[model samples]
Target: MVFIYVLAAILLLIGLLLLDYALGKKHHLKNVRFLNFESTTGEYQIYTAGDPLFQDLFQDLRHAKKTIDMMFFIVKTDDISEELLEILKQKAEEGLQVRLLLDRVGSFRINSKIIKDLRESGVQFAFSETPKFPFFFYRLQRRNHRKITVIDGDIGYIGGFNVGREYLGKDAELGNWRDYHLRLLGDIVQHLQCTFFDDWYLATGHHDEEPFPTETEGEKWIEITATDGVQLEDVFESLICQAKDEIFIGTPYFIPSERLFKCLTDALDRGVNVKVIVPMKADHPLVKEAGLPYMMRLIEAGGEVYMFDRGFYHAKVVIIDQQLCDIGTANFDRRSLFLNKEVNTIIHNSRFVMDLRLAYLKDVQDSQPLKEHIFQLNTIRTKIKIGIARLFRPLL
Candidate 1:
């Protein structure tokens, strides 16, 4: 009994030490707001593809007086991308402290000349993480998927869009990929700046000491929430429990954790109208296969599911009860919920939710409904593929 007691005490001490370390990290992250957007003027803007949002962003980049920090999962060298690169280069030449970070994996296909030109023009660049054979497996999973842009420590941008021809409506093959982005001018911009700095530090081992804006004059209350591993796994469960009235969600992938699946089922039992839209043609075949079982379950619970027919439905958005909404790069799948460093914006604005609902309705109009009978009609080969996908979902 004494030996067991001693072991328990040692375990308690170790737990406390871990708790202290986690608390310290959380305190450091307090400089970055998790779920709030603020500015002095209460003027926040939402931008989408082909909406002249890039023009406003370019104007801000041209007028930046102090520093510019940007991080993206992918950066292509297409026309719109070239335009932004030129502006960034010009800003760097003007002596503004310019920093750009891109994921090595996502930007691997991009032309090397574009990166060389940016570097030659004095723009600082870093890759989020590079794989080194033996140590690559663990490092590759924790990717910097958040897209952030901060200018002069005051204005910021964060959302799902990447610097690519497809996103900018220039991909001749894809033809106007539908997406959403937000331009922030408030306290939340500082959080974005801090997020960039964290990635910058991780990439280059340098941290910025300047004070980022935490208070701004914006009216609409927006909160940015992020979770990875168990924390992320739990957040969706909490979101599911809090959902009331209606839940409208759209994602390119749809594999869900059991807890989340149960929460949605419970919400439906309580008379909540649950609607979900997923891509009819997913970019990842394994993910599409893994999502089939979940679709069948959701349909069993009277949840409405729509399969987008126009190209790939890459957007990740969720609107709860016409009051709380989330938009960002994180998809509703095991990979995003467990391994990737994902960011999402939660808005508590009715107007924003309404706008998102309208957009979702438009997407629904373009989608084909997945009737309950569709799952019943699947062939044996399809079932075998789903089984294989389920087995490999963690990697997918």
Candidate 2:
């Protein structure tokens, strides 16, 4: 009887999720917001792990005069995280409004002492969302995976590096964490701050009414786009459709939804060069297992898949045709594309595009191409295993 009841509950949960997806497809998919911002002119800089990423972040926090807002998927209690915490505490003590948010699931291991110290120092900090007993199944599954830091509403940073020692390549297993982050100085900073504020309001009942910096005359075009729940399908669709000549994507995970898989195959059919670079070894092995079939299908359709062997490739970047690019926290997976909240910066600058393209080329040199034998589905059991894993792509 207990087994029957468990099965019934699982079926009901799946049914409810399907119904929600159906309703969303009928309504929310059409009204998807395509965000874009054309700043008067802005300064942009891209950073890798060893390129003073944390130093630049601490400097921005120290220089924050009016307000500082930060959000990340994970924030550990390691040296890097503690240094950041101390800086934010110091800034808060200096009468500058400092706000920090972390995803409950991702930062569950954060030290309680740091939280207490932050609160004692007047740093407003909170977890994005916590799943309770009754709704634990659904609530805990959706995470806020965006990384954003806006200082004084004039400078901003966004990308994949979470606040942890491992992110700085201090981990024994994952040596030299390879990731990407961007520093922006322009009117678009307010938009990034607003994204942080939205999550802040959701996490805490208190809403911040501080005014963000106004737009100045700039030449760069940057759009800070974000999505939560079932609204990101169209945003990604638009991106794939916009790629005319070639598409270069770098992500840690590669579990594409069926629609996206079809779009990629279509892109390949149209003679567009589709190159995907994923980590050779995933931090979560199941992510690798779940994406195997899709990656095989992608390769079968004439698309190229490369695996980065130097270090853990955690950068989420998409360069479209050497003319446009996207950088942020969203991975090429069902969780990032459909379930979790993610943030990305869409840039329409030829110079920046070429810069990103050059980096992609360099990374490609360090990657090994996917061999045909590795993707051979010669056995029925192997096919069954892959199919089973693919079914759980959303949860992976």
Candidate 3:
């Protein structure tokens, strides 16, 4: 009797949590606002590796004259993370206006001691997407996944790379951390700076609304899109539906929304060459399992899927017909697309898009082709995991 009662109570708790998630999502959609996707002229540099990217970023940090604003999904106390924090601290102590914002749950391991030290060092620090209120379960899962930094109101850094040793590929389990990031100059810098301040306003309730003058000189046309738990499906679906010849995608996660998946299939039916590159190794449980069915559907639709064997492929990018590309922190997954705050830059410059396309093809060369047979689910354990992944798809 006791065992049966305990099991029933456990099931009741799960049911209540599910109800909360459903209601919270409905509430989030009702209140979410979409940002305008207008193009901005800017100079850009893409970074595929961590070492050189950090080297360049650190150099810019040292040269920042007036102000520095930094934000990320995760910030650890590892070597590179420590170096970044120390740089921010030094700049703050030097009387430069500096602010650092991290995702509350993502940076929870940072501990009280580190927060105290950072405060003592004069760096203005705060946390974004902190859990609260009626929809506690859903709020806990909703995070701000954007990683962006602005310096002197002219320089901006944005993309998938978070501040950590693992991002530098120090983790023995996931070697050679493969990712994409961008450094920007010109009017786009001010755009990101404004976005940072907007998020800062949400986290700290201190409105710092000053738009610095930025000169636009570069030929590259870039558009930054900010999605607040809604509009991600529409954003990607719009892009996929517009592809004329090809669409190349690279992401660590592969779960796609239903309409987005349909748009890709429609593109494939139009005889567009669709190729996607994803990591073979599963960094998180159920993510791989969750995405497999979609991968199978993609295969059936004459699209191609490549499993990246080189390293943990953390790049979140989409190249459409070698004329447009979106490269940033938003992954091609439900959690990133539906539940989290994400920022992605869409480039309309043909030259840069072609360049990114060539690089993506090289990643495909280093990957293995995926066939429909892989989703056969031959083992019981695999089948069970996939079952759970399906049941918990919203949380994925």
Candidate 4:
């Protein structure tokens, strides 16, 4: 009789926990208030690895004259991060108006000593929506996953690379980190600066008093779509719906919501060639497991899936009909598509699209094509693991 009572109590506890989790997992895609698409001209430089990317960023930091704002999902305490901190400290001392906003959960392991030094040096910093109290438990499900940097209101960066040695392929565990980052110069950067200030005000409750650059017309068409958890899918669907030829997606996570899966299948039915690339060695096993089912469906629906084996493929990029390209921090997974505060750029330039296409072709060369039989080979235990992982995808 005691054992039965204890079992009943444990089951009740589990039920309540699931209910709490479900209540917090709200999909606000339809409610996302995307900033109006600003049409502008800009020069774009794509960075695939860490060395040149960091070099470009450091140069931008050094040359920044008026103000600097940075927001990232993760900022580690490694050499890369230390160097960036040092620059921020020096710039702040020089009166450059440096500010930083990081995600509390993403940078939880960052060293407090480094943070203290930064504050002592006059560098302003805050975490985006820090978890607190009863709200902390439920609010922890949401995250600000944008990676943005604006310097002098003239330059901007947005992509997957974070401030970490691992991102530079310096970690011993994860060999080489493959990712994509973009550098932009023009009036479009003002949009990035405005987005940064919007998030900064939300995090610190302080508005930026600095003046933004005046908008000017340029040579190429570019739109920066910034969205929170509520409207994450609007930009994606808007872009995908306009695809007339081919669609290429490269991301680390592949788990798709049913609605998005249906959209892709519909695209395939319309004779659009859809191809997806995902990391072979995932940082999260459960995330990888959750994606297998989606991969199978994509394969059966006349779409292609490629497993990137060169390294941990962390690039979130999409190319449509070789005419438009989107490069930013949002992945194809449900968390990135629906639950995180994400940012992406829709580049309407044929030259930029061609460059991304060349890179995608090179990546496909290093990847293995996934066939339908790959799913059939999974054992019962693996299938069960996938089912369990799917249940947790909402939280991931």
Candidate number with greatest TM-score:
3
Off by over 4 Å in 4: 1-9, 22-34, 209-211, 214-217, 372-377
For lDDT, the strongest prediction is 3
State candidate 1's TM-score.
Answer: 0.84
Mind giving the per-residue lDDT tens digits that candidate 4 earns over 30-120?
A: 3344656577778788999999999989998998898889999999877888899899999999988899899999988666787788888
Judging by TM-score, tell me the better candidate of 2 and 3.
3
Model 2 scores a TM of: 0.88
When summed lDDT is taken over every stretch of 10 residues in candidate 1, the lowest stretch is 33-42
Candidate 1: where are CA atoms >4 Å away? 1-42, 110-113, 214-216, 372-377
TM-score on alpha carbons, each prediction: 0.84, 0.88, 0.97, 0.93
Total clashing pairs for each candidate: 16, 5, 0, 2
User: What's the CA error at residue 135 for candidate 2, in Å?
Assistant: 2.7
TM-score of 3: 0.97
lDDT per residue (tens digit) for residues 117-138 in model 3:
8889898899999989788899
Please provide, for model 1 over 161-181, each residue's C-alpha lDDT reduced to its tens digit, 9 standing for 90 to 100.
Answer: 888667766656555666677
lDDT against the true structure, per candidate, is: 0.76, 0.81, 0.88, 0.83
Give the deviation of candidate 2 from the true structure as CA RMSD: 3.4
Q: By TM-score, is 1 or 3 better? A: 3
